[model samples]
Target chain A: MNILEIKDLHVSVGGEQILKGLNLSVEQGSVHAIMGPNGSGKSTLANVLAGKPGYVIDRGEIHFDGDLLNDVDPEVRARAGLFLAFQYPVEIPGVSNMEFLKAAVDSLAAARGGEQTTAVEFVKSVRKIATALDLNPEFLKRGVNEGFSGGERKRNEILQLLLLNPRLAVLDETDSGLDIDAMQTVADGINRFRDAHNCVLLITHYQRLLNHVVPDVVHVLSDGVIVKSGEKDLAVTLEERGYAWLTD
Target chain B: MADRLEDSFAESLIANLDSSSGSWLAVEEIIDRLKSSLTPAATKESWKYTPLRDFLVGFTGAAAVTPDITGVNQPGLTMSALSAAGEYARGPAALANTGPLPLADAALLCAGDAVHIKVSGEIAQPLEISYGEGVQVPIVITLEDNASLQLIERNNAVEFCNHSLFVELNRGSRLNHARSALDSNCCDWGLTQVRLLETTDYRLQQYHTGARKRRAETLILLDGRGARAELTGAYVVESNSHLDQQFIVEHRSPDTFSRQTFHGIGAGKGTIVFNGRIHIHPDSPGSDASLVNKNLALHPEATINTKPELEIYTDDVKCAHGATVGQLAEDSIFYLRSRGLSRDDARTLLCRAFLKSCIEGVLAEEVTEALLRNLTGP
Candidate 1:
């Protein structure tokens, strides 16, 4: 079953065309890698999927779990199980990480007509994920993304990804600013999160992260549209030869 | 013109004064200063952003004085009536001549005596003082050597009120002061002056929801070596409200330290003003002072004016000052929305975070609710 379907999606920002006539589809229970050079609209695609404002959807349609997503609010899309790990996570001081996580979880639960998690249960679950990601529990008391190191910010993003447990997770360059150890920890988290019930949309410029999670499908995006699609071997070829050969 | 109003106000005060009102020794000094010092006009640099005309209009009528007290009896604390406190009231009474303090002078002139509080040892319980209902309150506090106290002041009355507070922290003494003003349709005027001795510590946490018109002036003097002062304030201005705050910290002794941080929000067609000034004297060589004032404008029609000024006479001191006026970051709002929070929830969260640093202590929860009430639009 197709979890996400983008049919000939055309997106523009500030009256300038960025994503022109783009088409893509991700099946359920599979990982897909999107690789492109600079200015190839990789982040734009992730933002458009999250329903961020300022992007004019000139034309096309978006379907998520049989629901039209083009007109959906960002929070509505989020409650329906779509997540976007920001390339530059915002630093919100004074709002503790624990409080933010609790609000998010409760909002999602309320939207699905489920009871809110108790304090003890919520803390136990958060601690479990924090320990798995090697994150200190003390960090949960501090402001969200406040004074976090580059590697720590990436790990924090992955922490949310696993804890939220969304149907489709869009990792937008999450592995860009991480060291080898941090990268391995994040990849391990992704590996543990993928199961028969969910899918992952991995957006990146390097093939290093794919070495750990190992995408099932690889697609090359150029000038706002997918230029080629193949199996996982395509990522390795692009890493060796670069996009210059394919673009020319 | 403000000059005409000042003359009439001063005349009315003198005509209404009772023979008992002049019992205090500081009354003569206050009266002299009231006549000599002109009411603040918009042309003056210190009163540039504030509209004194609106403030003077509230004082045109007769004054009704209501006196009351609460939460003063506790261990290691002593309270005395101002008339019986004797020479102790002399110091605070002289403070009326410090500047063009019309409101402070008016409060002290009408007030025959004030509440005098003296702390000898560390007190665990906080002291509460309430002011409002056309009442003018003058308070004097003294912390002996190594003594400590927590003071909380609040006013919820619907009528205009004036408050004057004077604090003296002796050697090695400490004081934690907090105040909240959360009425929607009232007028308030307050003046706070503190003197810190050697190695003494003083901290103030002030929270407010703008009234019909409000003005607060605070002065902290580090008079002894190794003295320290910390001041934090947060306010929210809504429809038909006007708030003006002036904070001045002076380092008069060597090796003194002071920090001032304030955050405010403008959510209606109101006006908000903040002026923070730090002065380092020539003899104060090792002074370290920092001031920060940040403001957020939730509505374009609201007016926010902030200025941070620094004056250093010595070259061997560290001083940093900054002021900013802006709107909430769109990126932050979108980030929160993407995490499953609605737009309104995201705004409330961000607004609360923006003011979290300045609003704290026993009344944090209550003050937070009041400040965010009109801010989070319906």
Candidate 2:
């Protein structure tokens, strides 16, 4: 069975139509990339799939692991193994990152009807993950993403991705604003998250990230529809020709 | 409605204290205050936001607390009763006795004998003045030159209590004062007044989990140069309970500093009110003061009134204050929920975090955790 299937998915924001009857599918253990120019509804696709607020779905069907997710709340969708790494992750003032991770991990575990991780074991596990992402252990004590630089915020998202270990990860422009070294580290984290039973969806405007983490399939989204789907060469073609040729 | 309750409440409390051993002079000030308390409605400027007429039904038929605190194990400490030992009676205190508020006078009239605490040198274990049972009690504390001490005051589970705490710190003296009060169907009033001397530091922290009707007031006077005061308070009121916190800080001398951070949360039909006033007197050119009051109303039916009142008599002082009344941030909540917390769990986490930073310098971890648990629980 496909890990994610979107059929006739029409989504809008602020009464403006963005994703107009978009359709796509991702099989288990496969990595799919959606590359489009600015405002071609790349982030909107990730948001709609993660159940973000303020998005009006005119018509659509979203199935994750054979379960219909259109009516589910954002948190419920998250517990059901759908994760979205936001392009601009929010900075919460008082909620410490470690505290947030503990609560988040616990929530996911509880939703899965599994035993909660002990605080000691969880701390040990998260510290290892934080170190792998080159994050200061002290950063875990600070407010979530507060006072973090652009690169730090992006890396922090990767830390969550590694810690949560969701079955389907939707990364929205995770490569933007990252330096080469940071981009390589994030790619490594994403590569680490790839598993046989999980699916990975990458949303980007450039093909640079695709070089580090190759995509099994690439989809070109324009005006809310997947106009084209191809193998890795399609990304190189778009990077060389730009998005105008496809629209024209 | 409040006027009638005030009159009757004052009458019965006064009668009870008159039956005690206290001199008429002590109770006379109370009589004067009670007479003036009825006319000025809670709708007046200072008490405008507080729904006291509807919530503050004065306590009736409650007894006065006999001063039982004595001979604390800590060194450089002593205790006495104001009514029994006239020398221990510290008169003309500030706060509720400041010409307008009547609760302090009623407390003085009702208290069998207010506790008088004296510290002369470096004190170890905190001197505690607790109303462990159901009674109204008043306490007066004086720290001599170069003396330092801590006071852990616990007043909870009382039917009705109107108490006053007076603290005077001499040159280079310091005091750490902490109080915890969490009870219901209880009309509780706590008024604390502090006078700081040269180079003295006074820190007071009060935590409450609500009551039927409650008001916790802290008034600090930085009377000498280089004196500093840090005051923080947090309260949680739910159901039909009411919680009011008033912080009055005055920099009376140059180079003095005062800071106050307050947090209050309300759920159900409860009302939480915070009134923080900072007065930088003239000639105190080098004074620095700040007052911040933040409130969170958990349920739609809950209400919060937060006001930071600044009265500056000089242009040379640096003063800042801010008050914000908001519920849990939608984005913050969503962020937490997305991580795995249910909506309710996310709300609890935010509420707990709100109360954590506000209750500072509390030595007893269990006390602080207990208060946190009470507030975060449904």
Model 2: per-residue lDDT, tens digit, B1-378?
545665566665555443445653545655665666644534456566554443334444355665445347567887766664222223323222332255555555556466777889998776766665444566778899999887888775466666677788999999988888877667776777888989999888878877777777777888999999998877777878878787788888999999898877875678787888888888898999998888887778888878788888987889999999888888777767667677878877788778777866755464566655655456
The predictions' CA RMSDs to the true structure, in order, are 2.7, 3.0
Q: Which runs of model 2 end up more than 4 angstroms from their true locations? A: A113-115, A118-120, B1-18, B24-44, B50-63, B67-71, B83-101, B132-135, B367-378
The alpha-carbon root-mean-square deviation between model 2 and the true structure, to one decimal in Å, is 3.0
Per-residue CA lDDT of model 2 for A3-68, tens digit only, reads 999999999899999999988899999999999888889989998888877888889899998999
* Tens digit per residue, CA lDDT, model 1, B89-131: 3443344233436566666666667668888889888888888
Question: Could you tell me how far off, in angstroms, the CA of residue A223 lies in candidate 1 after the best superposition?
Answer: 0.4
Per-residue error (Å), model 1, residue A84: 1.0
C-alpha TM-score for every candidate:
0.93, 0.91
- Give the top-scoring candidate (TM-score): 1
* Total backbone collisions for each predicted model: 0, 0
